[model samples]
Target: MAYSADGTRLFSCGTSKDGESYIVEWNESEGAVKRTYQGFHKRSLGVVQFDTTKNRYLAAGDDFSIKFWDMDNVQLLTAIDGDGGLQASPRIRFNKEGSLLAVSGNENVIKVMANSDGLRLLHTFENVSSESSKPAINSLAAAAAATSAAADRSANVVSIQAMNGDARNMVDVKPVITEESNDKSKIWKLTEVSEPSQCRSLRLPENLRVAKISRLIFTNSGNAILALASNAIHLLWKWQRNERNATGKATASLPPQQWQPASGILMTNDAAENNPEEAVPCFALSKNDSYVMSASGGKISLFNMMTFKTMATFMPPPPAATFLAFHPQDNNIIAIGMDDSTIQIYNVRVDEVKSKLKGHSKRITGLAFSNVLNVLVSSGADAQLCVWNTDGWEKQRSKVLPLPQGRPNTAPSDTRVQFHQDQAHFLVVHETQLAIYETTKLECMKQWPVRESSAPITHATFSCDSQLVYASFMDATICVFSSANLRLRCRVNPSAYLPASLSNSNVHPLVIAAHPQEPNMFAVGLSDGGVHIFEPVESEGKWGVAPPAENGSANGAVATPSVGASASEQPQR
Candidate 1:
């Protein structure tokens, strides 16, 4: 046992009557043990020494090795030496500066070690078996006996040789007490580390916090993520070459690429004004994915996807652009929906507004082009869907969307319509319901309404293979359904995955994007500027099997019919 320099706390290490070894810290003022350190050694310990220089380290010796510890964390740092390396009466001592240590386990042999790091042997003297002195065979034999007797026992217990009246044992040497033992000195300590209230405050950097994530989309190759923040874009790239492994699978040897402050053009059109409310700004990707166009601040800016640099800026006449869509066959053609209930056809190659067509009676909320049917579909706040011919720009058919039955009518701003991979059918997300419709007849094929008790839908998307449908809710919950039958697959609760800084924040998934190549991968943008990626874990081929929470589900995510699922399907929470 040893008292700290301040004498307020004591560090002790020794063997119990049962031969169980222990190391502990004692708070003398309260007359109670402060902490017990376990799982470092197995045999009884020699005297514990405190480093006077830093007062943040402690070290001790068992029969065969020296153990170093960090007083700050009260945890073992390292243990060094060989079997029966220090025979009989192992004693440890440190120099004035505590940078060097002297340890003796045998009368004839002494070890000089460096304490700069974990105790490293610097020099060895004529200790026991050294050639310069007569080998003390008895001491070596006794140490071997003690070690062999404690086989498979606790490692924290240092094997102490039974007293046999032999001076060759460690009991022969005595610890030399320092002059500081009798002298009192001023104490310097930090809170929780020093006694007598001699505490100091420390300066630390500000903690990082989550920002609101406005939109999320996958790059054309599905190898990267474009996290559209309120005013910037954060890129998360999963780079992979054409290389494959022995199993003929793409080798995932490279870590994903990420940016710190994101790209240089951190400011976007939304930066023009500060709007605290949550809204999905209009953005479009060209057919070839070479460029991205964003509509905000009463104008539209075209950006090169690879460079993220503005290529051109267009100020729409009068009404601001609210939604945008690129023609599926031509990268130069763009269809911009405006607040004036009109669709403006623009030819970027010629830098001109080819034409303007009026159909919707209200502002357009969503627009999508169908390459298979060669037509354009647009939805508006009037709860109407209109189909138009691409060649002549004429309205063909229109249908009224069903009103939100169980919740508030959010169709005006929240309505979303997307075409499936086959382009023969489409999915419409409006209010609290998600419905699949046939593009030919524009009739509803299937529908799933959110439970009234659950949060409203914020964003939804299909899996890469179009076999699964995912819907993100305002509560940070996600429900996956089988696209074929519309039956619930499983529900996901991502709030658990939020960083500690965002755990309690009023955040939820605002948008979701699926990986184009990896069916098991997807990214969800949170209401706060945070992105949660659901990636496939190669070890188990299944998602995390967390402790049951909602209802009785085993995991909190929407993936698939787990290709390796052996357990029963997770129930709804």
Candidate 2:
């Protein structure tokens, strides 16, 4: 419905009473329809900016050619007759300067057209991977010149090149961190700047398929790309190369000559080449990037970043497995959370289950190991809380922190208890109250009532130094509060970030996790199979937030904003 350019403009296309299809543009400024153009041979699938500089638009769909339109007049400018280019509806987007428009569809090739009069085929990049029966390019973005903001020093917009297989086939869609997804192409970014004609090829492993990319995050360092897929998470690290004589005022023509090969790093449970069942539902890496803890179907897996292989699997007791966690120390010691409302301590180095502790009446939803004392604290859906000795889980100290009593069967959500960095206090976010408790005395320190419109606190995470606590609301909003007083600090509403398919579900925030290093950055996963990433900004003496959902909507009609390296990169699949 809206695409972010300056703000957002609503776009639509449909048939007129005369049976001919018409393209209409709405001016958000005036809140009215601006103009209409009716020149497409068939129904227009969608409209994308054809020339970013001129603020022009392109309309295409059933026709064999992409129609260019002057946005000011909504008049047909020209149509590039791609007799074979528009077999399937292609998603199109123009680069920052509107110099290049990348289009990809049902075909195996991703075509880049120069925004000249003839719509010149500046480049045609194809997926050479043998795993693909037919390489389908899901999306594409043009690499920015990387020189826009000299002082701030951000790389050019990283284009996200994604793909997937044709629907109707049964493929591996497990939410694991993998290179590709089942029946869909995994999302990847072009590390270098825009080289419209460059066609570097890659070979991908067979049988790996990417369904749809949920989110793509490019690290501030420009050395890594984090891709959240339907079933898994993937990390792509750039292989660094020393710049020989690089100087300032770089030209856009030198992206290809400056970079080296990139490598993929994954912490997956299904590391066995032949195992088909192991997977990674979601995962988080430490600030140091030395450790990665992942949640599989019924187990927690740990991995060493250097080798990219599983070091241990922390499975719960027999027939009651669910989640696991590794202490911040990255020792072989692991904490296991069970579906049967129990916490188990394991000495991974010794390959032994240390102890099983009884605590809550409901399933354990969250577990954290304090770095100060190496103590393990667990929270349950039953609104119960407890702490355990690092040496043994049997040394359980249960504390019934004060909570607003709710009706039976309506208990608090999981992972709402967030321990502060001091390790002396923690915050308990319940359906009706945000309670802060002192760990030493197990006493309620403070409490803040939740606004009626805000969803119950299902998940919460503390900032690095424990200055602030970010909580995800059921109403698709993330509220921030000062850890000192539990006072409201800021809020980010991701209601607009959801894909159209999931937007209407109004599901609770199923998973809320933040990057350990990027304190202002976090991700929210919804029940409707959509994951949204958000980052903080300080524009005018105040903080603001932005979502990665730019063009991503429902029905393959929306698009995610390509702000980072993940936007322009292409994976081997």
Against the true structure, whose lDDT is highest? 1
Model 2 over residues 321-377: C-alpha lDDT tens digits?
444566644445667676677776667667787778887887776676665555677
**Top-TM-score structure, candidate number:** 1
User: Residue 374 of model 1: what lDDT?
Assistant: 75
Minimal lDDT window, size 10, model 2: 165-174
Report clashes for each candidate as comma-separated counts.
23, 36
Cand. 1 Cα-lDDT: 0.56
Runs in model 1 with CA error above 4 Å? Answer: 1-210, 232-255, 259-267, 270-280, 406-411, 499-504, 539-573
In candidate 2 the C-alpha lDDT for residue 188 amounts to 20
